[model samples]
Target: MESESSSESSLEKSMENVLHLQNSDNPGLILVIAPLNGTNYLPWSRAMKIALCAKDKIGFVTGEIKKPSKNSPMFKKWRRVDSTFWESNGPLLYNIKREISLFTQGNMPLMVYFTKLKKLWDEVQCLRPFLVCTCGNCTCGASKAIADFDEDEKLIQFLMGLGDHYDHVRNQMLLIDPLPSASKAYSMALRVEKKKDV
Candidate 1:
C-alpha cells in the first residue's frame, strides 16, 4: 500500500471534505471503510460490489506499492498465512499501513494545519458509526477456516448485532465492484448511525 494517502479516486464515490454527517437532506446513508485488499471477507475491499448499487456517498483511502520487490520476506509470508479465511470469519489480522490521510485538496493547510488532521478513525467513531465491517484472510490460518455455510450466515448475523439501522428501512445492503484487485465476490450490510458528538 502507499506510505501516504493520495488524491481521492474517481474509481469510487466519496465525500471526504464534508463534516457533520447527520441531519443531511437524505434519510439513511453509509460511510464505508474499505481495506482494498483482494479478499472475500473485507467489505472494505472490492469483493462485495453489489452493496454499493444503491444511492449513497463513499469515502476512500487507497494505498499503492511502486515496488513489491522491496518488501521484506516476512510480509509475503504473512499474507500467505492470512488468506485462509475464504470459507468463514476468523480473527482478522492487521497489516496497518504506515499511515493514510484525507483524499481532498480542499484548501491550503500548513503542516500544522494538516496535523490537525482529525478525520481518521477517531472522527469516524465520533460519527456514531452505524456500520463497522471488515473481511480478509483468517486470523489463525487456513487450517482453522470456517468452512460451513450455516456458520457463515451466523457471522453475518453477528455483524448485524454490532449496531442499529439508520433508515426507516431494515437490512441495508451495498455492493460496489469491478474493483482492480478483488479475488472473489462478497456482500455485506452496515447499519447507519448519526453523529453522536457535540
Candidate 2:
C-alpha cells in the first residue's frame, strides 16, 4: 500500500512538472537570440535547443512528447509552445508560398519591395532546402541542374511581382538569351526606378 501511494505521488509530480508554465513562458517568447538566417543554421539550432531544454520543453520539439488530446489538461500549453517553436512544413509552407504568389510592389520604394520579397524567398528556401547529393561516387550533375532551375524560378517570380509600370523592362529581361539572376534583375529594376525619380 505504501509503495502504491508513493508511485501515485511520483506520477502526480511528473504531470505537474509537464504542465507548469513559468512567468516568462508565453506564446510570443523568442527562443533564440539569432534567427535562422539560412547560413547560421548550426549555431542557431544549437541555441534553440539549449533554450528549449532550459524551459523543459525540448520534448515537444524532439517528438519525445506526443501531442495530447484536446481534452487533456496539457493540451493548451503544449499547443502554445509547439506553434512558437516548431516549423511544421505543411500549412506554414503553403501559407508562405501563397504570400510569395500574391506579393507585389505597389507604392513601396524598389529597395523596400525587394527586401520584403527577399525575406519571403529566404524563408521558403530555409523551409524547403535543396537536397544535397549523398552518394559519394555519383557524377550526373543533377544537383547543379536543380539549383539552376531553382534560380530561374526565383528570377521569374521576381519579374512577375514587379509593378505594371515595369512591363517593358520585364519583357526585355525575359528576352535575354540567358536570363539574369534575381540580384541582377533587382539592380536593373532599381535603375529604372531611379530614372523615373529623376
Candidate 3:
C-alpha cells in the first residue's frame, strides 16, 4: 500500500497530465463535486461531457481508466480503483481529470480536505474557467445537509468555497447549478416555482 503522501502526489501528477493534454481551445472549467462512490457520478459526468461538448464553443476530451482487461498487458499498471474515466463532450479547451475517490477515504485527517482544496484552487487559477459548475447538492438528501455535526460538511464547504473564491477573484464566473439531469428534485423544485409564478 502506498503511503498517503505518495498517493496524493501521484493523484496530482495524474491530474496535471490530463489537464496539459492538447485541446483546440480552453473553455475554462466546470468542476463537478459529488461522492466518489455515489450512483449519480457516472451519469452526471457523462451528461456534463455531452452538454459541454454540444453547446460550448470550446473543445474537450474524456477518457476512462478502470481495471484493465486481462487480455491487455499494457493496462497492468493502471490503478486498481473503480473505472476512472474522462470524456470530451464535443470540443473544449481543457481535459477534465476527475479527482474521484481520492479524498473520500475513511479516517482521513482534516489536512486532506485542505490539500484537495488547494490543489483545486490551483487548477482554477491555471485553467481560468469562465464557468465552474458543481453537481454537489443535487443528489444530496435532507440527511446530507451541511450542518456542523456532519463529517461531509468540510468537503461541501470547500467545494462551495472554490466557486465563490473563483468568482470573487475573476469577476467572470458563472456557476451552473445542479444540472437538470441529476435528480427529480430539480424538476420538483421547478414545478413549485412555476406554481408560485402562476
Best candidate according to TM-score: 2
- Residue ranges of candidate 2 with Cα displaced over 4 Å: 1-47, 52-87, 135-138
Residue-wise C-alpha lDDT for candidate 3, range 1-198, written one tens digit per residue: 569989978865664443332343233434344422323445655665665455331233323433346775424334321112233332221332244223332343324545554454344333333322245554644433432223343334343433222333222212334222212222343354466569
lDDT of each: 0.27, 0.79, 0.38
Error of 3 at 44 (Å): 30
Candidate 2 structure quality by residue, lDDT tens digits, 1-198: 999999978965775586577788766678887876544656877898898888888887666777878997777866776676666566656877888889888887779888988878887776685676666544777777778788898889888889899999999999987888888999998998899899
Provide the lowest-lDDT 10-residue window in model 2: 129-138
Model 1 local distance difference test score: 0.27
TM-score of 2: 0.59
State the lDDT at 149 in candidate 1. 31
TM-score sort, best first:
2, 3, 1
Worst lDDT 10-window in candidate 3: 178-187
